[model samples]
Target: MTKRSDFLAANKGLRVARAGFVLLVLPHAAPDAGDIRRFGITVTKKIGNAVVRNRMKRRFRALVREILPEHGLAGHDHVLIGREGGVERDFALLRKELLVALDRARAGKGDPPRGAKGGRGGGKPHHGRGKGPRPAPESPQT
Candidate 1:
């Protein structure tokens, strides 16, 4: 769960959205030695400044710790992505949402593809972020 690759892999899993967060559940083809559940939380810069992000992270950590052990699906990797304005919501409300989301996930129901919405993730891939590829290094300046 600490590695970037772990998060990326979870992104390809089932996604359930709530008012305050998005839950991603990915099951391992086979569990590790202990068949334990592992989870991670991500709060992006878009959420706010460092302090705000840290606060949101703390809340997420508390919620996961309180609920996951009993309600979570075993042998899966869970990732909670904080959404904008999540910080303003009440913790109890968020906890309820998480529980509902986890139940939906346990039932193998996930929200629709986020890319289906217009003007966002879906579209042609950008060739590159730069103006364009360098022009063959100008032929080594002749």
Candidate 2:
């Protein structure tokens, strides 16, 4: 699932969020694609610097490899999205959470839709320069 489209498609699928990460399960849509189970990891810059993001990705990959083979659903694209505290979390705990997430996914259970929680978005968009053109500097008030 190296393509951006794959990730986007997966985002529209089932989502299970754990303390350490969010798991997205996209069932194979095309019969011709076969039962090829693919997976991807996304750790954004918001999580940390490059080093921290990479470390989280590494941990996610290891956990996926260890657990996916036995517990993962075939013909699905599994995407793990890293959260803020994921880096500092214990590996054992993360692994346990992943297992629980997978089990929930297996049972066709997913957390609420991302937008269900709502956002702090009623205010207008803000830019660093502030309030659109600053009233054209007021021209000394004549």
Candidate 1 residue lDDT tens string, 53-119: 9999999999999999999888899999999978999999999999999999999999976676665
Off by over 4 Å in 1: 118-142
In model 2, the runs with Cα more than 4 Å from the true position are 118-142
Candidates in order, TM-scores: namely 0.80, 0.80
Clashing pairs in 2: none
Q: Mind giving the per-residue lDDT tens digits that candidate 2 earns over 1-142? A: 7999999999999999998899999987788656577899999999999999999999999999999988888889999999999999999999999999999998999998876765665475456665655555555755
What TM-score should be assigned to candidate 2? 0.80
Going through the candidates in the order shown, the clash numbers are 0, 0
In order, candidate lDDTs are: 0.90, 0.91
* Cα deviation of 46, candidate 2, in Å: 0.5
